[model samples]
Target: MSVRGRRASFISAGVRFIVILGLSVASCWPFRQSQDIEFTFLLPPGRVECFYQPVAKNGSMEVEYQVIAGAGMDVDFTIVSPHGYLLTSDFRKSDGIHTVEPTEEGDYRICFDNSFSRVSEKMVFFEVILDGQGAEGGGDDEWADMVEPESMLEYKLEDIRESVESVHRRLERSRQMQTLLRAFEARDRNLLEDNLWRVSFWSCVSLLVMLGVALTQVYTLRSLFHDKRRVHT
Candidate 1:
């Protein structure tokens, strides 16, 4: 083969490798073991909210929750199995994490109860993670079709797969960290707002009290001066 033609062929092969790698990564995204559902909601006083997640037999589920903003920053949390069996329960907690390994395939119920807090509504953040249930498959056949068995690229498939999985795990960790950080930020913001209001209110009250004391002193001094003048006259 001519030098130019060989170079062109090399470039084409590289391009194909990159394209196939990208497609394989994209195809694997939907098959991640840990699928997460996250939500933030306002739970009014004396109200309860429940959510359901379906899990396959032998699958695992996790629930994490935080009370980001509210009067007491606490709520009652509960998890129930599909067979009406209570799996977990926490009373008046500000944050919690629970995990369940189900023996039966069905929907599990997760609930947040605010009935104990009759006057203050709560802002709740929660995440549900379903694991051990992803479909098992890969794009190995696609890679095989694009690359010859004798080619050097075929030898690197295992390495490529490992790298993709590592990257995916890192992304999942990053996502979870971001979620927790957001919840912390929201709680901090609420605390700052509350402190600001309390400070402003007390400052105003102090100012009013100081003014009242000054006025009272002025009035007493003037009355005494008038009495002294009358006595001298």
Candidate 2:
């Protein structure tokens, strides 16, 4: 081939290669989903509820809970490991988070206790997230077979996804915190109402007692001061 013709051929081949690589990346984009679940339930007085969550060894399990409504807006919480060891114990807590790294590969128990409550049913909100460390980097070697630029782009995309996921998680945490604040406000309001009612009731009782004493003394004094007109006619 002549020099000018060879240059034109090389340019066309480069353009074709760029387009093919773009299409390939577009066709096989990688995405992984993290596990997260939330639940809300009513816990009746004097009852205990337990949930079993399966986690692999070295994996992390995160749990968060809030008591939205009840007499004291609190409940007893416990976490038990698969090997029958106590992992966490919270007594009459309103809201909190607990994270555990499992040493045994089996089901872990999470229990909510309303046994100390006798009058009110509790509304509990809980979230469970499993951080699967075992799956990370399991597929990275496949990217090594690709060209360096392609591999770098893929990793960057993965990092972007991670950042987006992190933002989403923060938003969720904010929402949960707002809910917890509202619940606390409600509990305070209820306590204020009960106190007001008690004060009013006691005031009324005191007023009635004072009135009775006053009337009784007045009648006794009038009877003692009666004129001596027993034998007029």
Candidate 3:
């Protein structure tokens, strides 16, 4: 084969290989679809439930989540970081799209409050879509290998959910205690007021009795003195 022809053949092979690799990578790239993940929690009135969404840690981006409330109930949401920072907060907003951005790769907490709902929240969904360049990586083997035992995102999120749950339980107990205390306080106040009113009523009655006795003594003395004065005159 001529030297130039041989070189041309080698270049053609290289181009084919490059094209094949490009196609393979593009086909195997991670899916960044929003519906890939779904998280739901049911909280009774005046309670909060939280969950985590896995995200790419290396990039600077936001986790955009779509929240749909079960008919009749609205949701109030707050995004907390692994470190317990309020990254984002919203309230009284109807079901719609929301976004949360993290500074680093870690657990991001989305707290769903059910207190806003008078009825049960039958369904709440969280769908995570990568913002940019989203790569889930190559082969099934490569994908499996990239997954850590527990991602920082998962770990931090779990911790936050636990914290919120603990706080939720505490809040429930506190509310109950406060209600009982208020009942007791109200009863005591009413009883004391009633007693006070009764005491004043009796005190006034005693004062009138004392005044009546003094008047009787004065009249008796005046009658005796007048009789003596009349006899002397």
Q: Largest lDDT belongs to which candidate?
A: 1
**Which runs in model 1 stand beyond 4 Å of their true positions?**
1-30, 136-156, 228-233
**Candidate 2 structure lDDT:** 0.76
TM-score of each model, paired residue for residue: 0.78, 0.59, 0.39
**Candidate 2: misplaced stretches above 4 Å?**
1-32, 118-120, 133-169, 175-233
Q: Per-residue lDDT for 177 in model 1?
A: 87
Top model number, TM-score: 1
Tens digits of lDDT, candidate 3, 94-202? 3444555434566667777767666555345444433432434442345456433333222332343345446645665576456445544544564577678889999
**Candidate 3 error regions (>4 Å):** 1-36, 40-44, 54-71, 130-233
In angstroms, the error of model 3 at 57 is 4.6
Q: What lDDT does each candidate get?
A: 0.83, 0.76, 0.55
Question: Model 3 reaches what TM-score against the true structure?
Answer: 0.39
Worst 10 residues of 1 by lDDT: 146-155
What are the clash counts of all predictions, listed in order? 0, 0, 1
Instruction: Order candidates by lDDT, high to low.
Output: 1, 2, 3
Instruction: Decide which is better by lDDT, 1 or 2.
Output: 1
Better of 1 and 3 by lDDT: 1
